[model samples]
Target: MEEQQKKEDGLLNKEETDTLHVDQILRALNPRGRYQILHILLVLLGIPSAGFQLLSNVFIAKRVPHRCAGPPDGSGWSDIFGDTGNLTIVQGRCKLLLTDNSSVVDSAPCVYGHQYKMPENASVISQFDLVCDMDWLARLSQSMVIAGQGVGVVINTFLSDRFGRKTVLVSTSFCLLGCGLAVAYAPNAIVFVVLKFLIGGFQQGILVSKATLFVELLPVEYRSVQSWLSGCTWGFSMMLFAFIAFCFRLRSLFFQTYENDSFMDESLRWLIANGKMKQAQKVIRRIARMNKRSETTILQQIQEKLVLRKENGAEDSERPHKLVGQESCQRLSLLDVLKVKRLLFNSVCLWFCW
Candidate 1:
């Protein structure tokens, strides 16, 4: 009996030593190889588009010089400096002056809509006639995009964790493309605002899921490099956005969405964590082939590691013992942050910075 117990203990130690974590397996499979480079490049393609979507409104809804319309065609600017005795320009943008024999009779609102000095239908401001009382609608559309981003971060984080990163990333990319196109052709200001909100949400989903997938796939040593690369890409994309806006103006928003539809591989770590052994094996084999490593050896190692992990998990579940206060301590809430002074301060600082 004593010898049997000793043998069981020795086997447990051996199994523990043989079991490999996801990070170790990634490192063994050649983390910084052809596969990683290709994957990183594909992911980076979407970052610039995100920058364009975020800043597109700056050019698309730019304020153009305008004044109230006048008599000749009712769509032309009022002859403020002309010798027109019937109509005169008012001091403010909303009101127009009407006079009889150079004596002010009354001030009238822009009855025929304002005429913009810019090209016809150049911007939402001119297209929707969003001047004076209606100008607030343009500003609201911009704010809605920002509000959508904030909401998307919370929602996509939960969705990615539940349905896997690849699904959320692909779905959001397609949705963003659709929403972007719709916004460009929106028939009214309301439709434009609604589509911009959805675009912002999908854009954020792409960003969150893409970042999570990229980080999880890389080895620990490569994560810092990924961060630096992502930052540089974003900065360069912003600069490129300016150039695109200069050359193409609002037309740039329509083309930026196409690049985000590139093919992307599912994360190996996510597959394994979600108990998708077959898919995980398939991804591993692909990675091995792309990295020019021995597929058979890596597959064998991964299988043994997974088997050991399953056995360990089963054994843990069979155990009926429970630690005191473990159940209560397992969960935390937002209130806990308020309870801790240091945590509260840090949270406030981060919130302010963001």
Candidate 2:
């Protein structure tokens, strides 16, 4: 009788009960509130880091050009002047507009300033020029940094369905980091372009998985708009990147590069989504400590979700699943869709209707 009661009781253990409480709250306060919270959190997460990254880049140029170059020239002026020089690289857009100048009009095949600039003092092989070509091609390269991010979004959407969220995130993260590093150190312009493309592809996969995983874990009401809002964060994130890019000029990879001022930002969300919950907890604890706040154990949160999902799954799958009228309806086979008679009839009908 006790066992029967235990099984029959709807009340769950500590975890499930807490989850139930949260569900009740979700149901009580409109889902809109939670989505707002989610959006706020995402924006909060994306903006500050982006700002820091930007400001840090500026600081690197102004305060620490030595960090990029081997040593400071004992004069602090280069650091200040570096910011002024960095502008030429980011805002220039002559590269994309006129692709074939020779065939078309006054346009000529534009290359980077670093590529063909002839040095006055050096011989044919040794001559160098610091002046960038400032053509449409360079403009396209500038646009690609943000365009690549959008590509990441599209790529992630498809991959999430095929390869599961966690796997895609980790694999893509590793790939992005590798490609990004390669981009930072590519030997030539061609190699740099290839690496940048790879970085964009991998980044897209990572973002999709991140979005899917977050939505899956979020409460249902929070899931709807929050999903779309998360996407909005990416747009906002681009602005953030632009800010950072403006500040953090990438003129030279090793000798000079912008710093990302993400002040102690070990993204716990990234760690948790990647199955590094222990590390996440450590991060949470550290944050709590730094802020002089109390830390909440997520273990209970996990246990509750597990029980709730398991119970829901048991309730769903225990009974034989069935197809409804729309689902059960036979889809027209390809043969039916492409039948010659059907095509002719449709064409004739279209002609008559038109």
Candidate 3:
């Protein structure tokens, strides 16, 4: 009877260890070190560029000086209109009056088109003449870019979950760079808005992936401070956007090089989550070597943890009914949350916030 009790106790211990193996591996890895800092910085480089691209429409859709098109000398407005207190040359900049005192002039939009008086700078507004009656197009263009960002957030998050974060990050970076170049040379408003939308989408993907990569590389204790610091990049990018857009016109070209050239490795947590344990183990060893720690110690801990799980699986075969019951309890679906009133209320609130 004593031997039977000892055997039952050992089986329960094995079950507990098997369920908590991933957590144990995470705890075993020293997540805080020089390697963590380096990974954070490398991933963070793409963020400011994303911000710059996001706010770039502000500069591209800038309002410039404009007036009614046609020669000012040949127009009869000079004879009919005079420089009165209320009636001046500037007042009729875009329109001309038939009689100043009568107030019976036929109002008309810019006849030929509108003449823009911008400085020696080219933008989407100047290139396409999105002024006067077409001013709303500028606002619409900006809105489309923002809408693209929302779409990107949902799609990219889903892709990251399925295809892994590294794959989505690299693909989106190139897409953004290519689309931005297309925006610079767009022949019409339709093409420009389409390209801008795509740029906004890809930009969001990079932003989410960068943050994900940074947080995963950090230790639990340092995550709060690290996240706070990372958030500051947005503000930095706003200021940098002005300099890059005004002084340097090749911001997208720079982004292309920055993203594609980085020789960074994928996240170890991601590798493990995807069931690529061999790749994860290699990454762990590499991280340990970079941090000047003993790789043997890390590898040994991982092997021992894995062996314990295998042993637990062999013993679990004897208790099929218990295993099936545990599996059913552990597997939860979205509908299960709605069955619980408290969980359903929290989920509704979370959806609204999102």
Scored by CA lDDT, what does every candidate get? Answer: 0.74, 0.42, 0.65
Report the poorest 10 consecutive residues by lDDT, candidate 2. 62-71
- Clashes by residue pair, model 3: none
Model 3 agreement with the true structure over 75-184: per-residue lDDT tens digits: 54443443334443333445644444646444545555567676424556666777766767888888888999989987897777667677788889888878877776
223-332, model 1: which lDDT tens digit per residue?
Answer: 88999999999999998877777776554244445665446788877776655656766677788899998866665565566566676784544534322123322444
User: How does candidate 2 score on lDDT?
Assistant: 0.42
Candidate 2 lDDT, tens digit per residue, 1-354? 743343333222322232233333223223344333443464336333322322222222222111011113434323333332322211122331222323322222223222322222221111122123413333343345456656765667556554456667667756655665565455554564455555556656655565555554335666667757765775676566555555535433321322221233333333433344355455445543444443332333434555666667745335342221123335443356356787768867865963
RMSD of 3: 7.7
Off by over 4 Å in 1: 1-18, 72-92, 99-105, 250-256, 300-350
Q: Candidate 2: deviation at residue 316, Å? A: 7.4
After aligning candidate 3 to the native by TM-score, how far in Å is the CA of 314 from where it should be?
13
Predicted model with the maximum lDDT: 1
TM-score between candidate 2 and the true structure: 0.40
What's the TM-score of every candidate structure?
0.78, 0.40, 0.73
lDDT of 2 at 324: 18
